[model samples]
Target: MRSRSTLPCCITLLAFALPAQVINKPAQPNKFLEAVGRRAALLGREDGNFEAWVYPIKILRDFQLSVYIDNALEPTPLSGLAETVEVRPGHVTITHVTAAFTVRQTWVASLDKPAVEVLLDIDTSKPLKFRVSFIPEMKPMWPASFGGQSTGWNQKDGVLTFTEGMGRFRPVLGSPRFTRISEQIGHQLPDRTVMIEFEIDRSGRVPIVIAGSRSTYNEIIQDPDALVPAADTFYREFLNRTTSVQAAGLNPSYDWAKIAIEKGWACNDGVGCGLVAGWAPSGLSERPGFGWYFGGDTMMSAWAMQDYGDFAGARAALEFLLDRQRADGKVMHEWTQSSALLDWPKYPYGYYHADTTPLFLFTAARYVRQSGDRDFLQKHWAKLEQAYRFCLTMLDDDGLLSNQKGGAAAVETGALSGKVARDIYLQGVWLGGLAGFADLAGWRGNASLQSEAESRLARAREAIKPWFIQDKGIFAFAQLKDGSRYEANSGWQGFLIANGGIDRALAEKAAASLALPTLATPWGTRMFATDSPFYDPVGYNDGSVWPFVTAQTTLALFRHGQAAAGYRYIYGMAQATGLSGAGFISEYFSGDRFAEGPRAVPHQLFSSVALVHPLISGMLGLDGDAMAGRLTIHPQIPCSLGPVRFERYRVGDAWVSGAIRPAKPTSTVDIEVQGPTLKVVKQPAPCIDLQEVKPLTPGQRGQ
Candidate 1:
């Protein structure tokens, strides 16, 4: 690791290198609001599923605040009761109103403690009592469940404690100063709830805190108010450590994406520490809808993590996956948080995905290229080599990676089923992995290994070319088990092009096909074209619009010089950020509407990355190799975005900040650098000469 003492000297050197006219003021923090009126009252019911992590041990996933005015048994609805919900980085404030009183509840997940705090304030004419319910499901995340689980509860003084799984989940609840408090435990059909009552005079404030550990419980009950502010400070400081974007069209959503990605970072005591797929309320389901450590999802989102300079978090994710690599060198697909209670690895679910291994290699190489962490590469080189060798074993006779060896590819359980022989998506990820391995070998001075990887990559590209059906203007989605082509034009093509390993002509053709209305939706690009035999608007993988897939497709367009066509999808994704949940992106949306499905998660990690990665790599056009000490800027900023500022973006050991103003002849760039010596390169690009880009026409069919 580099010495911290050298930072000042590097900053001094960078100060002299920066342009004289460029100046940057500290960017302001972003906030979001969800107004819950009569018409949009259902929006208030969407749970933020706010979570807190106390490092490598516990995670507190608490439901949204449910208020009960007077003596109502259940939490009241917001049709005419609540006004608005304001969501910030560290906390969420919900304002509930009635004819007799106005109650404001501020919900926070302690950054340093395994607890969640809800600060309550009431405004009324006389002393009145009200109830607030919290269902802290003291259970592990999805895919790992405890059979014959036992539960116990105890109440001492004003604190109520709930325990389960032999003290594995000991949740205690109480307040510091609120004296007039009483508690009740209600046995709901599916989930147990703890209801606390508090009486207030004309105007009073109270704190309702729930903690998972004794240390946290004691700390919170003593200084409950401090936890909320401390969490706010923690988020502000965390944001300072990473990058932020400032532009006209993109504000709060960009910052929201930053928090969305960071919130996915989870650490378990013995299992491992890394990024979970996403989080949602575990209402009646065994899992919180993909709330488990996934190798493919983590590696996929690590690109966005690197885009915003969260190198440490990204590295930790890589280490987490490395610790779980199978004996045969294949990266494990998914590991649940509840593995400690069961024999998880003995099951077949961990290595079910064909793409995770290659993604591991690809993401690792990308991390090193961006952060220039050669020590990491050196330490993990053996495991990475093993993963590369494992990839070689999966290649079919045609040289393309087959999905039938030991794992499934793309569509897991949808209308498109059966064992896939070789899919373009897997081939694209494998090619990227091969390219990454080649680069790593070259860096390690292994010329023979580099040559072998390069030769195999060339062969894979040749194998994939025949899969493209020229008459259809798109590539075959996959080759079936019977050696027949499934020639449905899919958004999966975008995944192949995003890696830049495919032929330029083929990428252009795929990008053009992506523009067809059969695949492109008003919200985002559908996984499958609407006209397909297996098209289902709400199907998980058939026709749903996943933000990550949309992002990859849009990024593919930008990579192949389809800038105008790509901007529409990017804009649609940004808009979707506010459509369902404030400061969050839904996991998937219907191909026909702007809404998410019944079981869709409101705050998804890769869905958030859809906003960050595309804006950085696609719009800002930045590619950095810290080891080479070179930072290249090839911007394709659309005219609709107006002037753009990319602040505090990190390239290896250096902090790069820049401003872009799109123009006809040429776009102007004002950049500043801090930390490390670096060479800046500005590549020539097609001059942008368009006005505000509008949304694409809906319901149009493809040729």
Candidate 2:
């Protein structure tokens, strides 16, 4: 049998060898035309921006478009005055209509280049001029700063080039039909913006190319008519590379989530390459909202990427983080795209999070399990050991992982006050990492290493009971520096259910607490129960409903055999996909209502996991041990989802095609496999074992 590591090469070879018709077709985006005011824009009118795939790409956050009649009138806002908008798979079209003329503009971020292309078609009786404008902010995203940044613009070779900060980023805007090119330089980068104009006649099409470099922009405008179709094809093929879910209400958002994940894969010139956390307009902030490489977010989002057939994407992300893993084994918390331009490491924010290390171990193990990449483990075994060893140094007196020693945790700045000695959330992740490390050790045939991990795993299991506030029927949110418990009904309980080795009864009890009004909301599970004194509906970690957190709780519920409850949360979070953006999910939402939180990102990379992970892992109950050539299919889907057909679901090197038909007592499951032979098991999904359910040690029982 071929190892999953070789699947990517084989798939690429097969793609070239096989006929095109046999390949899966990309999902067709529904044609949508709805009138929306400027406030209803996904990224907000003032802060909205678009980005394209470019090594040294321009951040199009403040970029705008307008039109002028006869080249004599004032440039009218076309985007802000948009009467209807149509968002397709890889492009967005905004339409503006008036008593005299109707204008439709389509924007596409070039799939293979660092250029953003726009196709403008006008239906005006009078001669019109279309304009593209933006102030070049030559600064990379936040946390990485460059001083003396100034904006300069020059027109040469019929293209207008905008330069920023010691000539680091130079972007050009040009069109074959350009009427005029102009710019205004400022003392600093913020005070300047550039404009490109195009002459338009009846139903005339103009292509405007904005690129990271002049040559690239010139090459694009030379054959501007071909950019949009090329971009559309690129996005389609990219989506077709992953699994497709044909469940009635689920496919749209599922496809959207796939796009969001694919878009998250970014590469900076000299900084590094990996999945970014999320992207929003930078606005007044130096950085776009979380628009940089994030180790923790990348690893967590990789779960969903692997769940679908994007194992290559998952592997790429894992390798990116592994390459940058700290010398002492702590995974990075954040890496700004402009790190190469600044003294990034000198800052303390990179390795500030304690949970990122364990998440690395967990995600590495998961990638190997799901992708059957034993060679990856063999190659990076020493680094994995270092990560696990680093985790051990953070243990508190009770044997649970301590946030104080490691770094910032889930509740970094809010919800919990004072120095936290330990938290059940971090401990649960630690338990999961320990289990994962043991698996890695066993895979490497290192019994001693596995034994050591197992030992700590057992000790942590015994120590966790003390944090269970028995009266509240909930796990303590944190153990402060004084070793006193801070009890609160929190969504973090789901972490224990999903990863911590809590007993089935205890997991069920904790999952039940999530059903209470204080913790459960119409949108999803709240970070903290509303009744808690510290709860804040919009607080970063206080009471917001993070879709990723909801995912943990949903999976926990399913792991504890609470499928109905899990489905409810899944359905609720899925609705946000339709609400916030066409197919995008926001970072978090208000715990008290269906609205997204004030600063929630329109498209968060990890937010997709809330749908993809649970829908595949929980509802479909598809777990893979690709290393063992085994896959377990234990569907716990509710009838409410109706019949579901999931195809091209990747399990290591193998592909799974499954159908779930609701029946009286249970759903009938039919699964078909391709690529490699697999031992398909039909049974209940696996859960964490509570250290053989043994009683606690005598010294610890009374605590």
Candidate 3:
């Protein structure tokens, strides 16, 4: 939870503040090949440029075969592999294959394109087997020398070799043989991309003979007469084994969510880390370089663990945050290389913005509930206490948490400059955290803390009302101080409402007002209003429809009893991003009319976690009453998704297994309540009082 005073300079310079035109311009279509599940179609070539829409996914590996004639007898330069060939509308003609092969030449394609189909018509009857050699994209000026040393490359005979120290190259070839090849290719930094070369032998054995990069010194000799086979074993294996989720057909948002999760795991687990932008390491590290602020990684990891019931992963992430808590109960914005607290020059060491603590608290509470590990709470109570105290201290004289620092931008530096205001998003986090705390406290028999948390939550709601309500609708983004408004139609605002911070009436108003045709793209809700000055379909936080935002908003809609609307949004987002073999989700999509965008950036983790909401809230209809350790099971399956079944593990060792099948307009849901099973009562009878739902402690069995 290390907070920084200045927003990461890299984020501003590299991510946000780039020129609008450059950011908004259509992403190069060829880049889509790098993504995993992209469905690339051979859209008729237009004016020499191949046009295609790539369905996004996390790519494990890719290979290409290039065929061309050597026109010049003199040795031609084999440089700039990316720029050498022109991809014409109908077909890409390879003009050269270097000096190695005179009549027939072969090369592996870069993983940057989504789907590539070779147009060559070679005779199948002949023994002249086409060899496709796969090689990682190598750029000049790479294999940088660090620690004042010359990092050189060596090729003895036909074996190309490059060496580096720990925190260097680690190849992930998706197989055991590739691991050895990856070792030969220089060491890889967590965030940096590295290339590996695999040769297809004449006997059709695609053994990766060498997998190292060429040194920048140009001292290493190129391999001549290298054998390349047509069949790429790794890619074929990946394509053959990976199966996409069935939900992908009916829901684009969920599909994207699945893809994002897969990619995040792939990158984090060293499967395909260098491809995606967000999840890839910022530097070399044994652990995936997950940022600490707002417990973003913790929340995402929790979402990822939902399906498999990976309580250990959920616990480890929670522990990571708890271990970093400051004495004053605040989480830091960022951590140093040694895992020490990042001390921002301007901000107090322990001072924090509002969201970090609350997110952590909620996530921690969820872990405890799912695992039924009271011991963990006992061990981390002190840290939780400090966090709660910090949250309570943030409340202003008016009951709402005050942005003592300059809001989100200042949480890092701890400086209170510029606009000294509160934001609705932060408030939502605070209230949500408080709600989680209230639930946890009630479960633990801490009546005092629970009551106090309830009072604080009530005040927060009261305070938020005036600022968001305008023209009988909820404002998109709101400034806390004096109730001024900014960004009238924001998906974030919808998120807060969907999460239960806003009242039902207000939630409905916000949903109705924001669901405009212009603002709601085919993928999901746009990040910004269509009329806003900053709206750009491709720009991050501008108009790009992020699956993460869509997922949260859809969950919020379900919370407000607008389940149909929630289902529609999730369905649309999933459909827009077609499923890939990797089963991961894309980070974002074009908010403009185009169904797709540039696909270079692969799967992300947070986007994938968003997919779980529909499974939990819509398909299973599992709603937890945290205080009572009780869950209400009401299945509301969409018609298109005919039959669905799942098992959900809940608190107190209770398990809820259920199936939902279509019954004309309505669906019939049958749930088998296991563990300390509760009596099944159909809805429309009077709502059950909280006390009536008995709380089950650990080891309790249902009759």
| Number of the top TM-score candidate | 2
Residue 147 Cα positional deviation in candidate 1, in Å, after optimal superposition: 7.0
lDDT of 3 by residue, 1-703 (tens): 1111122223221111111110111123232222121122222111112221121211112243323223333222222122233321122233322234322112222123223232222322212222233323211111112221112223333233322343233211221112112223234322222233323223222222222222311221122112111223323232222211233244333333433443332112111122122332111222122211224544655644544344555565566556666777876443322121213324442233456776667767766765666877878777876788887777777766666542352122111223447666667677777787887787677899989988888887887777655664765464635554464576776546766466778877777655666566545677666776567776665677777677666776655555556665655544434222123355666777433334413345555555665556544556543335576666554555555544343434555544456555456655555567554533311111111112222222212
Candidate 1 ranges with C-alpha deviation above 4 Å: 1-80, 133-137, 142-156, 176-196, 689-691, 694-703
Which stretches of model 3 miss by more than 4 angstroms? 1-145, 152-201, 209-248, 251-294, 332-354, 403-406, 409-420, 480-483, 532-534, 578-582, 595-600, 624-629, 639-641, 647-654, 662-666, 673-703
Query: How would you order the candidates by TM-score, starting with the best?
Result: 2, 1, 3
Q: In candidate 2, residue 695 scores what lDDT?
A: 22
Better of 1 and 2 by TM-score: 2
- Candidate 1 to native Cα RMSD, angstroms: 6.5
Alpha carbon lDDT at 25, candidate 3: 16
Clashes of each: 1, 2, 52
Model 2 gets an lDDT of: 0.70
Better of 1 and 3 by TM-score: 1
Q: What local lDDT does model 3 show for residue 89?
A: 13
Worst 10 residues of 2 by lDDT: 32-41
TM-score of each: 0.87, 0.87, 0.63
lDDT of 1: 0.70
